[model samples]
Target: MNIKSILAKPFAKTVVAKIYRQSNNAVKVQQNLMQKLLSQAAHTAFGKDHNFSEIKSYEDFKKEVPICDYEALKPYVERVVNGEKDVLWKGQPLYFAKTSGTTSGIKYIPLTKESMPTHISGAKNALLHYIDETQNADFLGGKMIFLQGSPELGDTNGIKTGRLSGISAHYVPKYLMKNRLPSWETNCIEDWETKVEAVIDETIHENMTLIGGIPSWVQMYFERIVERTGKKVGEVFPNFNLFVYGGVNYEPYRNKFEDLIGRKVDAIELYPASEGFISYQDSQDENGMLLLVNNGIFYEFIPSEEFFDENPTRISIANVEVGVNYVIILNTNAGLWGYNIGDTVEFVSLNPPRIVVTGRIKHFISAFGEHVIGKEVERAINSQTENTSISINEFTVAPQITPVAGLPYHEWFIEFENEPEDLMVFAQKIDESLQQQNTYYFDLISGKVLQPLKITVIEKGGFNNYMKSVGKLGGQNKVPRLSNDRKIADELSKFQQK
Candidate 1:
């Protein structure tokens, strides 16, 4: 380990702003500060600019601001895309982070220069803190392969844009700029398709030592590298000091990653957005991720029950409990005030509140007259399908509305590793498992309120092509296990003819 990396831990990545800690004493102090800031932002965002008051209480702030999901504020997003400065943010948005919502069409999220520092600084702090916790400062010196979205930048007319990840081209640690994946002049596709080859080649030949990215896409790259090099992940890149992944839960993909690598790869969780990186896994080997302080925001959590199947919770941060899943409500320097990021999370503890991202609220489905949340579906699938050697690569469940029959049943499109003969039996097991967690689904199924659940086994790369055809990137963002409905099932089945 180098001396500079040792000294850099606490000092190098200093947090740029002060955030409210989750303590009553601190809450009291922050409540006063939050009101003043929120009031001030209102004036600034709405043209009064200077006459603003400090936030006095969480309740008061909540009453003043309405909940905002991306759908509710599409006009504001359009303003940012059209470069409308005053309506969206004080400054013109430099880029739009294209985030896909289940019901609310594709979101062209806004990001400004002033607002941009939150994610950048937070990510840096996360890396520094990871090094500090793992006591592996030397890990910082290795090449990092960000298994991110395709690199193709913007459409010629600027109407279409790349993944939120493509923005990493503009901001990364200036020092590690050379070691990072994307080049200054190259587009995102080149970064992924073209530059990725160099990263793979270097990992094999130059002793590359670090890997970071979303697990699925990262796994894809690993598969490609393995296919090309004829060497396993660990043997080809033995010096890999760490692997960082985020954007989605690592539970389902973790063991597969280990199996391929032939070793336990050190990993850190990254919670990033086109707008910002809110929290990073601070402590090494810890189960939870800490909220980065001074990361330019006041955050809130609307209780899970408040939004289990409602309009959505835009609750206050102070009112949040220790072990509840709540949708993230954020007030940040990025000109976003009382904004709902749409991500659902649960607190592991309240003392400085360590949170685990539960899932997205938008990704829930209610097909068989029973609302099945993403996590519930995931839990059922993980448990019921554990014994099967055939792996489900991508899948979605939709309501099969038969005009002849009034009942609408769940139709599943599953991409499997190996085709199983008893597909109906597999569906029954999963149905049974789902029934255990959600009584409503079981009741509906048993009463024949919905038709018998149908499963259509898809070709291996069916969903992958479907997403590519839709212009969605092929990582965590695509085909989340459970979705609102299976609109893409037809597109998924297109691979059978291929």
Candidate 2:
């Protein structure tokens, strides 16, 4: 047996045991984690301001600290950015994970020494659990390519600043470093197109067993590899049995990805963000990702129905019920207290507390009281596309409130790898599918309050060009699948014009 196989035997056994123990008592684990985080940050500026030291229970913590969004946390983040020690966390942050902002040009989320382990260890344990469950240790014998952002980190106020993936790349375990592809020089190339090309050049001939990336970019890399080698991914890397992905929903891209690989591979989904590592897909038995309860981050859930209320109800893991869409809140060792991360999720199981990411709070469309979410929209598209041979490259939906010469309607901008024979028929099917899913949407169309959905066939690479123009071309960047406003729709128009 190989060294990896030998090592994985013991490691996988340990992780499997831990998973069982944790799953059995997730609520207790989460409670203890919250207490530990609060204790660690008690003396920090934010903690002191919130009386964290005296806050002894979840109820007390909830009463003391108000839920805040990025805007509400901006001042404290700025203080940390200006080299203030113990402002949010215990010390100055080691780095800032920069992300596209909702209210501002960019958001700088602090990545502290205390919180870094949550990202690294959580990711490692996820894979370990997968191996434990599958008994698949041969993957460790070959290289694993992670298509991440540039490893060349930029400095902001004496602290490193970059994409969360880039920061995490700096800390890959030394042993696995041997099996990782793309030299540090190639990883730091900055431009995504150039970086992808370099990655393909370096990894095409290697003994690759695993590939991890945001599905869209990985698809681009796969396309390039196919072009160069004149072979499907399975032919090039027959040992490749795993595809690890997150950051965006994979359902829409599932068909195309499998086609590129020439067969379906085992996939592991992760719920990682600039703020913290939240969850991961632990077992192939279920679709929901297992929440990382014992991780450094403490989680709170506010029901999406109550999220917009002046006094929204924030509930702990003990009280959260299955099937309720909740906007996630975090109180992390990184010193964020009751901070709303903007994403909405629904619990699929309460015993182990597995969750499915439902949508983003900012990415919903309620333009005419027909509340439509990302999950609903994606389901509609998936249902419509599953019946046809067409494959989607990328898509985004927006409300066209003021069309030049027609009633207001929901517009879809789509780029297809295999175009349908009849575009109008395809569009009608999507609209009908959506109506079947959302009663509010169905009522709007039936009441003649809205016109039929409009479809715009974007040229290949239109979304990428749009993201590039807005300086958000790669890494965790993705177009909002659905939007109430026309910001994304307007930008896509500019790309079409060019």
Candidate 3:
């Protein structure tokens, strides 16, 4: 056993606190930790499989551990679909968090016990930072209503076979066995409808003060509140102090929610996923402080140029510069040594580098926080699109709120070879594939959290013209890997006009 691992016993919080205190920028501390992890993780994750434990130098780690999409992780996932374990790691993975990756298909991200605390502690620290910033001790004193996943703890076909944020939410705490307050723990919500109802009933008239979660979902919960009680949102919950959300951009969804509630949205950013809380916005003015779980993950940054570099490799975070985008490389506890997270981000500052996520490294749209990536989207469309002879040369997706205003839906601009006999039906199939793969998408739609889906079938050669305008029609860059909402859609529309 690697004795160096013991320093991580308390998930390295003191070290993080120390880093926070001593370092002027996050760069110095990050490099120090990487130097330690690069040497140690090789032994910690040794001999798990070809997929796990492949770290030599930080550069080798980046090259060898190729970027993975959800579909790429499917073979390991099929085992979870069949209730098998030890495939993703040496030991049994306690639960799986179903993240709807950039793909229209699902990415079931596995969260093991070792890496879970970092997630929970990061979350707690985020909250602590919030309280510190706001100077509100009562934030946690009142009922903390998190508009999040199913309040289930045990595993019973729980997101094992299918996609569900509720199920994924359930696994988060269990994986981080230490962070949770055991006495405060509740029942495993096996039934979806019942679980939601329970969550609703629990929060409705109670002293639900500190509200947290995605703005869209919080709006969904607000709708549920409005639906269950004839009273407008304001009359029911006058005590609500704050709202927290992440996953999707909040600017568009904010005004509508505020109008109904008779309150300005006091929203905060969260960098959470099915795997863990990767980062969190610490203060009102500051960008999200990357609480590097120094013990749990070894960090590496690949130059944004590395995407075009013939000899691309991961570089130390110590050496990264602000304003440059880099593909995030992670060497985490769950036997994943020197892994590239496939997401892209940039540092706002070097001293405790506050990172703002630019987008996915590989093309993928996370219109929702489902963590969708290029391959999963491609896989979902390729087999079916190819069979139908509707050759999808290229595409872009944006969250269009026009259908129901606050309730957004994925708007697809398809460049198809042939027009479908039943275009609506074709769109339905696409929606079905996505919904089946990503349960969270289905949940929001079915629950009326979002609007009815819309598909805009564009004219042939739309993508080519679109690419040309971007001045990246040919080489490594074709079009964006992902587009979130109206901004990208408008750009695409302008190109279409040309």
Q: Among these predicted structures, which one has the highest TM-score?
A: 2
TM-score of 2: 0.96
Sorted on lDDT, highest at the top, how do the candidates line up? 2, 1, 3
Per-residue lDDT tens digits of candidate 3, residues 40-95? 43332233444224444555555555554455656665675565655555455555
Maximum-lDDT candidate: 2
Comparing 1 and 3 on TM-score, the stronger one: 1
- Of 1 and 3, the candidate ranking higher by lDDT: 1
lDDT of 1 by residue, 62-101 (tens): 6556667767667666666775555545556656667666
Least lDDT summed over 10 consecutive residues: which range in candidate 1? 15-24
Predicted structure 3: lDDT: 0.56
* Distance from true location, Cα of 305 in model 3, Å: 6.5
lDDT of 2 by residue, 1-498 (tens): 579877997888897788768877988888899889888888889989999999989989988899998889999989998888998889888889988776765889998888898899878888888888888888899999889988778899899998888889999989998898889999888888888899999998898999999888898899889988999999999999999999888988887877788988999999998788999998989879999887778899999978999988889998999988999999888888889889999999987789999999878889998879988889888986774667888899999899898688999988887877998888898899889988999999999888879888787888888888988777677788998999888879765522
| Alpha-carbon runs more than 4 Å astray in model 2 | 494-498
Model 3 quality (TM-score)? 0.59
User: Comparing 1 and 2 by lDDT, which wins?
Assistant: 2
